[model samples]
Target: MLNRRQLITSLALSATVLALPAPGLAQPAPTTRIVVPFAAGGPIDVTARILAEAVKGTLGTVIVENRPGAGGNIGVGAVAKAAPDGLTLGIATTASHGINPWLFSKLPYDPAKDFAAVTQMLRVPNVLVMNADAAQRLNINSLADLITYAKANPAKLNYGSGGTGSAGHLAGEMFKNQAGIFALHIPYNGGNPAQLGLLSGQVDFNFDNLATAAPNIRSGKLKALAVTTTQRAAAMPDVPAISDTLPGFEIDTWWGLVVPAGTPVETVRKLNAAFTEALRSPEVKARFATLMAEPAPSTPEQFDAFMARERTKYERVVKLSGAKVD
Candidate 1:
């Protein structure tokens, strides 16, 4: 019933329709999981959540999971062992990547070999603080005063840290080495307990992360002497940097992203672009301001070099402090 030309045209059209892709058959977007090596509600965990939320539209269905234990080694080790598919990533901190290698007797994963750096996310400065009453009693109003008093009193002054090899501990030790002063070191189970020690006058002073100590400092329970960074913290502009008093003194607890070492370069680039965009967002910047942390996004190569430098610096601090987890 049909002419030959019409029949041929209909068959060709049918072939073209069948060759087109079906919408229902398209592959689903992969889910991304970001592991935080600290407990929920901590600074690193909070930062991870913020980043996950910011990147959701770009990266699709990103989630944050907390796996806290063994000074962040457990979660980081899990990430190190994850498939190098770029689906499982981690939020790495100064303690996890920089100090742990030197402090632990045996790390489950090698920092350099097991993971690829994505980008440095943020940097939080530690503050040197004393109990309000203690500072008033000792008439120490500044870092210089504390240093002079410690040099004069020697073992009379004591400092508290979260524990051995914590960023706070290493900061205290580094201060001691640079200042030529001696203050007895007291290691508590965690940062909160160490802060409690300082608040109750059990410890003379402490180096605490500004994120955790900002509330107390604002409430007048703690007196901030200086921030442990090269420059003054935006959150506490009135407080000077420790470097202002002790030339060339700086220690900051920074965090970044990393994936298993064998991940494809294209996948790493995609992640870096997403996170860097999030870091530059005004919303993320405002939230970080509330935490007294600064957004410090870096390229993958830059982050790798930064971590290497940090490792070298902390190795010296650990050796001088004689800190070991074994």
Candidate 2:
């Protein structure tokens, strides 16, 4: 039905259309990946997964890659060494960002220099708890009484922790230093066994993670004396903070998001905005509560300052405790 000139023009138009990509065949959106420097099924990994889902609209398809090993050095170090693009990010834990630099003689990454902080994700408060029977037997109803008893009865009390360099062990050391008392430290294989040891009366007290110890505390098996955070944890407002008695005494496990150092300020701001917003969302808060973690979002500057203070504090505590990576 077409004349020769019309047919030639139609053929040229069809050829041009064929040269361009169709809508469906256009390039797929790029994905952003966050590396969780811990094993899967853990709270850090869960947090990363939650953020990944929450930021899908802003960040496209976000992927969570778990690269856990060597006290989280393997994965976190990778992040430190990664390209400074916002595409690759990592979760920095208390051990990874706060303690590892001092614990290890040589570290793969410098906590202070290697990563740009996005924001503090959450803090899991470690609590000071005693066995119900032990507290009752010793008439230790309060932190003040515990400190007094520990002072009067030198080396008469003891505690258990997950391990020598764990948050619990360091908290115990801080307690001894600040309160001017002595309490024997028994380091179990892990937190569970340590909690079990406390439950079975193998150890008199422990600076235990609130999440694992909460049920026991509620069940009257363990008596919570104080939380290690400066402020009382939202999960347990009734319990007082140890800072109330021993000024400036604080210790806990925490984690946050970080990108490799040298990442552009704009990229860092984007990541901070996405994650901090996610942390503020109601659904995210609910999920964090399920893990007994309180969202402690902060600006990048605040996170950096906090990490510096933590590192300085832990340097003294770790040295005083005489704990080193094995």
Name the runs in model 2 displaced over 4 angstroms: 1-20, 23-26
The residue pairs found clashing in candidate 1 are: none
Q: Please give the CA lDDT of all the candidate structures.
A: 0.93, 0.91
Root-mean-square deviation of Cα positions for candidate 2 versus the true structure, in angstroms? 4.1
What lDDT is obtained when candidate 2 is compared to the true structure?
0.91
lDDT of 1 by residue, 131-232 (tens): 999999999999999989988888899999988888888999999989999989999998899999999999989999998999999999999999999999
Q: Whose lDDT is greatest here?
A: 1
Give lDDT tens digits, candidate 2, residues 113-212.
9989999999999899999999999999999999999989998889999888888898899899999999999999888999999999999999988998
- Cα-based TM-score, every candidate: 0.91, 0.91
Model 1 lDDT, residue 100, Cα: 93
User: At residue 312, what lDDT does model 1 achieve?
Assistant: 94
